[model samples]
Target chain A: MADQYTIHFGILGCANIARKVSRAIKLAPNCTLSAIGSRSIEKASKFAKENEYPDSIKVYGSYDAVLDDPDVDAVYIPLPTSLHVKWAVLAAEKKKHVLLEKPVALNLKDLDIILEACENNGVQYMDATMWMHHPRTTQMRGFLSDAHRFGQLKAVHSVFSYLGGDDFLKNDIRVQPDLDALGALGDVGWYCIRAILWANDYEMPKAVTAWREPEYNEAGVILSCGASLRFEDGKQASFYCSFLSNLTMDISALGTRGNLRVHDFVIPFQENLGPFYVTANSGWVGMSIGCDPPPTEHLIKTDLPQEALMVMEFSKLVKNIKVNGVAPERKWTSISRKTQVVVDAVIASIGKGFVPIEIN
Target chain B: MADQYTIHFGILGCANIARKVSRAIKLAPNCTLSAIGSRSIEKASKFAKENEYPDSIKVYGSYDAVLDDPDVDAVYIPLPTSLHVKWAVLAAEKKKHVLLEKPVALNLKDLDIILEACENNGVQYMDATMWMHHPRTTQMRGFLSDAHRFGQLKAVHSVFSYLGGDDFLKNDIRVQPDLDALGALGDVGWYCIRAILWANDYEMPKAVTAWREPEYNEAGVILSCGASLRFEDGKQASFYCSFLSNLTMDISALGTRGNLRVHDFVIPFQENLGPFYVTANSGWVGMSIGCDPPPTEHLIKTDLPQEALMVMEFSKLVKNIKVNGVAPERKWTSISRKTQVVVDAVIASIGKGFVPIEIN
Candidate 1:
């Protein structure tokens, strides 16, 4: 029943996140899960069975087998941050399109190496930030772009935090230096940084300064942190990410003419609809006792989950490159690198005693 | 039919804010608008007529006459910032309970002078920050204090801004160096600093740092600015106040177990009720695609307006001093001084090129 345009996908890990992505691949009409691989054959087989993959899906004991599968047109790499460079580079070298998990690499240096491999192999590359593909995000963008609705942006503040309980603090790979060294900043701060950049049209900040007194685990992995970014035109953005607070994902962007607030930016409160609030040309009423027109709430409905839309979008790009003989889209790669640049600057600023790091 | 405990209030200066506070005094059950004074007798008489004050109200050509009135148990001074030290101190010295408008004084030094005058004369002193008396504010404090619902506070962010338009930027007393001097910071930022301190239970931040590139008028009065504050317990707060943006007032407080968001902190979107959002012990659900429990919106209804409540509270203090022979309430003076201390530090930080200013 598979169409000729459907991209055959291979998943290169049995991580918990892979379960969600596997479902997304199934939901995406242009993508089909062809194979899955893990270090342990039994684990891969069990994951396929538990996730209800059909008999046509292939199971392999090693990630290399998935990359080597000639039938696979693309690979979704959800391995740990430390393992991304090794598997993603190899997948790209094998001419399979790559969908890499975030904090894509430990630093920009490692990310550059992986990006270079994809460029050389002419493989489509994109990071798996699902929220970017949401229909609500597009709606919010339209408001921000309209000069009458939202004029020149003046400031943006975002917060992405959740109380990752005792078990996560002690045993999670995210808190382990060898696996996800950046910890909360990498795991949660990545989305905050990405949201800031996305709101700013991917323009890199002129400078980045990390807030002082970041909390760290015994392993020296950051448990919570915040940073401020300053753009060239005096526009500013600040974000806080933590594994020690209640669940909150908020983005408040203030412009000359309008204000936009999305309380559930990284993840919506409901799966089917995402809501955002916007107020344009708002002013005071009745001796400054109340506002004339309060912020209006707009809810966007989606037929499929945001993650599936991400997969569908990536697969469309892959199909264009494979079936139409076109080059891979460069937009995703550019924005991903820009986000990593700010992350690196924040880390650098923290390293140097909370001093501001100049961006070039 | 006036009660024996009713406090008679005389307002000094016919500033725009006085119009609202004058109405509030009439609305307050235990207060009566007995007198009003401006530099021009016609202006004072016209304001009394326009605001529909009772026939018994007195109109004086000079603020000194209002302060000199023996029947005026309390004097509300809505004079400009530069004139606050003069009129407020004189009003207190005249043995009238001093209800001064904010930026209570140009600095704590001046505020101290006014406080000493009130102390030496045995009169209550309170700033005219109306929102502080809102019933919704008390409800929010309850949430922040709940150990089970909202644990130890981690961070707070507040913003207060309004587009003052070209005429205000050019001609308003707030933008004139010799009149308001502190400009937007004194007018709008005052509320933001107070909100941050209110959220932190009035615990002062040890250090304050202003953000870079504060927009200023040609007279060198701040039009917009932001600052970050760090407390001794590692709790942090940041706020932005502007006169060049759409009207927006928001406060977000994040604790270990809960998050509190108030979209309109300075003034509610509606006059009769104020709404706030809170989420306690929230977490992800169903593959981290949505939040388990969404934030609950709480609307607090108020009988009289917040400004009227403020006048009533101030009058209660005045009557206690007059009838019950109790010492003037030090709580209002203490918090007002604390707020002034932070405001002085923010201005000092900006003066020093965005360097951190230690509170001590």
Candidate 2:
């Protein structure tokens, strides 16, 4: 095997997702966690010691220190929704590649800043939306587009909700009242919105109307919201997201001929369930549940840990960057723009008392 | 059994649905077809002769003549969509009950006229929305309202479409441009919209925005349209209807705990497809397909023919008209008002380029 291209990683946050990605980095074939950064040096050192990274791995007291590290080739940012653009741009300015967590930024303006900075620095930037990377999602897209079976797309309905932890109510930047004004939209709702846009082949919505309930601490910040999006082709999508409900996720697409539904759109592997399957003429040909071995009809199985799979994919992209200097696909830019538009509409609709807001 | 009240029936339209209902009326325990009316008397005579009604059963030369006969206690108005209110009122004034087709009228004004005539004449009136009488539908409602299953109602997404037939295009009242101008909404789409409202205990929508394809005939009428409805509690419903697509029907309700999805919400018995079942927590428990011994979990299985079921139910109501003075639950005045608001909003939105139309 051609010697695996080594990529050194710098993590900008020591939160749970960051730790999970750190472990994934260690497991990746061609990557290592070369640096760790946190607002507190003690936390950074403690994370390094607990994970047993070599003493050579640098621990930085601040994010900028890690960005300036000459040994790090790329930065993994699992920061709050608001700081995604800032740290991503800083890392790009230092010529380091970036794998930013979902949402990329709180708004389109911040996302544009990161995109321009990455372009100027000639670096690869990816929004780590692992759900799209899964093979079953691609299978779903194929099933929906197949004219012989699924026929013309009519409408899409998706829901992603979960009861969040008390820590979410703390001073954490993600739930911070002022910074992340739209809590669910910026955090979990982004995934559901992205899936709808992706399923529709990036067709921009002609109009959007939303209903939102703001959190108790911040009247300006949304806790849960549902949006109705109409596309130019007359197709429609209705999606819901919440931080106050127990975890429930599902997506159903209706077409001219038939329909396709996915019970869980995200995290197919942590499931102790059977293989997640898709059927065309026969609706929902049995999907396996909770930690069962793959059934005979199982099309795709994510036996690997989710974080590890994402890290593996990120490592491949970094290698491609080194070999070809090619930038990652620009799809993320379109997705980011659409997501911000939805977030803006949700917030605006709440202010306007849930009236339909046209997307120009 | 107290001499089952035999209701002598007269059918005004000789379409496929009319034939089905006609046969169902013959099989009903307390109903018998006494007359057949068609613009062509020869065709009406032939239909009555083939159905083997008594020789005394009249073949009316015109629909008005059938209403003029005092022997006919009820009239099944299955005529063109535009003629529903005209004949309904005429029959009611002549002291006859009415089982009007799916939509009661072209709009609320016409519906009001029909209701007023029925009230003034002391006769039973019902919009023959057959799906409501399906056993499975009642069972579905039970599951949704079950406190142990779905807790607080949250959202609803529904769709119903069917490819139009040549005959449906030729003589079907739905294609007449003016009478059925709001194409899909009045046809199959109304079922989805009504089902949502019914599931929520008739909690009307607070606002609506809709879009429709503007295909006008000489009389200037819409052929297809879709709408989004917003309810007071932040719950929402999105529905689509079209005359150009093949059959596809589904309704899903999401609640605080679990959810319910009905694959074939309408016409579940036609193709032998039992309403396929699934829940958020339980996954696909089993199929509701094929009528044999009937599954124990099955909440509704009506061996009675569709038209016969409606006739039987309506006969019971008509028999109790004097004792109960028209059961309040059987009338749809309030629901019709709410539906008309949505219909008007949809028409306005389509005309105004999908601008938001708030319901009062």
Candidate 3:
């Protein structure tokens, strides 16, 4: 199956993540970066030239042109967060498989529209939350499957924060109020919220109360936010996200027997820092240092231009669609639905002054 | 003042915590254990004898007898949680200062009765939560006062859990069906809630939601509980307490600039563990590890126990009450009112399955 088909990707943005995804597509055994698109013609031409693609690899000055390309089986949308839904719908309308960036949309309404468009067009639509596809996350789920060992899942606590420099913030969509959908929450917090929901096997929260400060450049962009979500099965997740500071990521799940915490979920094995650490039950027992593989060994390490890992996964899904004649059996629809519900709840909670919002 | 005053103590209920308090009294230079009372006369007598108290120390089977003893200036009531109201009221009626165990009562009505009794009898009534008296907690408050260094106060997370043995299950008042109180939230969660409220300077929560698991033996007793509190200031606190688990104690406050976390609020400094550890902003900066002396230190090592610090600080406000030939001030009423308001909110939240109870 791997050799029989390849996912042909059309890049929709010339951003860093998009470049990484393009490179990853080139590296993926069953994937190829078939085209490049950017708002700037020079940037699109230069990216295609640097990648040394054939003349058949289309270069477009607009996202729709890339979406309309015949050779491109799928589009990786790494545009500003605010544009995720618009491009996702456009790609879906063009019947191109889409890998939309994290958060999917600024609110539930836009997410609903994108979902509808994908359904109507019968094209695969997925929010690119790459951590959900990681082996560590899969392993964590396996460990938690034994209810007796883990006991009743009680609470989940997560944090994702990073400091940004002026250069990173200048062209960064996250800092642009009009381009960025939500600030810390839409960018990083979505990961924390999604991770908690995914780890709990897509349990939808019953209610959520969130608080956001006014430190962001825009009132709508949350500089720092905290949310408490209560689930129907009596489980809870407390999440925090911030862009007003440097990088520090942690996700902890507490149960009757003990707790499982992972530090640096998104990019566990970074150069210099080594593999991510998992502390269980106050570090009473640990696997010891150097036991896990370093980031370079385990992580997809390359200087290739491309989108984030999620984009790469979407490309894989496209390749699957091209070979199988249908989108991969919708195992992730529930996840997408749950994620959207939480995102909607967070937005509602923030608007309502941390008022409890019932997640429908 | 220390040389001139002899701190006389009368204790109700020879429970485990009561025994610890008795020992502390014995160790305190200015304090004397004048009386011990329990439902069982033999138990009270044995407890007095084991402590090697002189014959001058009285042992009473009835709580009222201990309260009526003129030699007993302060009455420590660690009776069954359900009976706390009754005994505290009786002690206050006899003009004896009252130090009651937590929850103060099964409900706010009982707490109000105790408060009224103390006010009418001109006696003090204090809920014995020693964490507030800890020096480290005071230092934490000082650190949080600098809003810029700590950033905008965001949220607080706490958990206090311990496995319950058969003895605790069989006799602990918390498991009693008729008492009608959520077990974990009432037993250990009050401390967590108190810490959250105190850290935020007694800000009343605007809303609260709670979840509780059914009891192992009694249907009414809660085996585990979790609650989310949202304050008017847009700050939030998530707390969990459980009896069906091993010990796990933590309190963490998140602010914009940094965070303040105490590993163990209760018994921070012990013989082996040295002192509680405080980590700020991910342990990157402003980390401090120090022991918190026992509450007794406030009386001997530091200044006189402020009327505000006394459990029965309100007792002095009753008619004709004279302390050192001067009328006692009414300042403690405000603090007690604030504490009651939070306690009421917690009970309401727990009863409503952690529904968002709006505070008036």
Candidate 4:
């Protein structure tokens, strides 16, 4: 049943997120879950068994074994942020394509080490930001890009937050200073920052200023924070991220002629369809007591889950590089880099007494 | 048909907003539009005819004549912001309850002058923020107040904007400093600030900071602006208001256990019903790929429009004061003062190079 065009993916770590991505790999038509590796043989074996992985799937005790597998065409790195550079670069050096988890590295300096290795090895690199592959995202982008419908962009507000509860607050790796380091900003804020960038067509803000108040945990990890981004042409954006609040993911973009809002931007409430609202050319009705046209709801249906689509898209690129001799796509790497740059700026601004940090 | 309990209202100016309030007065069961006043009898007479007012409605050549009419129980002032202190004080001095349009005055100092007059005359004072009377607002407040459902507030983000277009931007009274000195901040930002305060149960923020790069008109009046408010308990709020963007009125509030959102917070899309969304205790479904318990849309129905409800509430207070000799409700005046204080602080923050202005 195996096809030559199918890309075999080896998950580098059995992190909780890997379980979802592994399912995505299985769901993707062009990819198969070839291998999984944890720190120990027992851990890897237990994970594979618990997830009901097929007997044909390889289980390796050490990550090096996964990279050494001849059939592994791509490696999905879901290691902690501090360990990303070491493992991701090793996977690229081994001639395996890299699909790294977000907050790719602790900062840009380490991220460059990973990117340079991937480029030198002639392999595709993409961050595992699953929402980018959602069909609803593309449709929303169409609305935002329309000149007559949306007009010139003026302001955007985004929020991504969820209450992690007391157990997660105390025991989660995200709250461990040395493991994730960036904490809420790296985990949830990464999504918010990516959303703002996506809305602005990947254009970097001129400057970013963090809000004055940021809640920190005992280990000095940010639990909640927010920032405002200013553009050269007067377009503005602001985002708030927290691990101390109930689940809320929203994006509100205002344009000269229209506005768009998505309440569940990070993950759709239902996997089958994603919904958004658009109000175009609205005006006052009857002495300004009410609005003329209400925002229309748009629901985009997808046969494949967004994560599966992401895996499928990544596999297509890997297949292109292997069979057709096409160069690796650079767009994914560019977006990841820009997102990390803003993340760095926000942290820097917060560190500098809430001063505005100029984007490079 | 008028009864002793019915409150008679006099319109002090023929501003465009007055058209809406006049309809509200007529729709309110306990209120009757008794008089209309402008600079000249011709303007007042023409307005009365165009609106198809009954011949029993008095047309006053001057505002003083309406104030002199002993039958008028309350004065609804939709005059320019600059004229509020003058007319509001005069109306209050005549022992007339004042229903003033927002931004109640240019600043807190001027607003205090008007408030003091109302208090001295023992007449109720209320700002014309119609959305406060929407049934949906009361329901949303119930959710926020529920300790187990919404929990303590963490953040609030609001926006109120409309594209005023070319001619309105150039010639509208809102853009004229002499007429509405606060411009978009007073006109639209008032609602956002009020919403923020309302979400926090009228607890004022400790300090406010304006975002950098506020767009301004040629007359030095702000066309678009945003600000962040920080509370003593680490709660945060931010809002954006503009005359350069599409019609958008939104309020997103995040709490420890739940979140609340409304798209059309200022004016509902449909006149008879308003909608809001609440997602309580949401969590990950299937390895965080999607959310559990999607936000439920709540459509609050109302037989009376929000403005009419506002009129009804104002008239009820007037009737209570007139019939039962009950003291004027200080709650409305206090809320208006708090909103004005925040407005003044936002302007002060913007003026001081986007510095944080402490709210005292």
Q: List each model's interface RMSD.
A: 1.1, 14.3, 13.6, 0.8
Per-residue CA lDDT of model 2 for A1-360, tens digit only, reads 225478888999787667667867776677888899999999999988877778988999999999989988899998876777778988999999888887677677778899899878878777777677666776778877889767777677787765455676555565676666557777778888887888788787776777433334444455567777778656768787766543556676766655666656655423322234333443211110011111112446555545566667777777787777767656655676677777777667767976677888
Residue lDDT tens for model 1, B1-360: 467899999999888888889888888899898899999999999998988888899999999899889999999998899998899889888899999899898899999999999999999999999899999999999999999899989889899988888999989999999989889999999999999999999998988888877889898999988888888666778898999888889999999999999999888889889999999988778777778688899999998989999999999999999999999999999999999999999999889877788988
DockQ, candidate no. 3: 0.07
- As a whole number from 0 to 100, the lDDT of residue A194 in candidate 3 is 84
TM-scores of all predicted structures: 0.98, 0.83, 0.73, 0.99
lDDT (Cα, tens digit) per residue for candidate 2, span B1-360: 214466778889675567667777876787777788988888888877766667877888789888988778788988767888889999989988888886667777778888888878888877777667666766777777877556667777777766555566555667667667656677776787787787687887776667434333344544446676777756666776665444556676766656666656666633222354434332211120011111122434567745567788877777776445654333555666566666767777777876677776
Candidate 1 runs further than 4 Å off = none
True contacts kept of each: 0.71, 0.06, 0.06, 0.90
Q: Model 3, range A289-325, lDDT digits (tens) per residue?
A: 0111111112333332122344556666666667666
lDDT of 3 by residue, B205-247 (tens): 7776664432345555776667767775456677777676544
| lDDT string, candidate 4, B216-323, tens digits | 888888899999999866798999999999999999999999999999999998899899999899899988888988889999999999999999999999999999
List each candidate's DockQ score.
0.76, 0.11, 0.07, 0.86
Docking level of model 3: incorrect
Best-to-worst DockQ order: 4, 1, 2, 3
Q: Give the runs in model 4 whose Cα sits over 4 Å from its true position.
A: none
Total clashing residue pairs per candidate?
0, 9, 25, 0
TM-score of 2: 0.83
CAPRI quality of model 1: medium
Q: Estimate, for each residue in A1-360, the C-alpha lDDT of model 4 and write its tens digit.
A: 559999999998889999999989989999999999989989999999989999999999999999999999999999999999999999999999999998798999999999999999999999999999999999999999999989989999999999998989878989899899999999999999999999999999999999988998888999999999998778899999999999999999999999999988889999979999999999998888789689899999999999999999999999999999999999999999999999999999999999989987
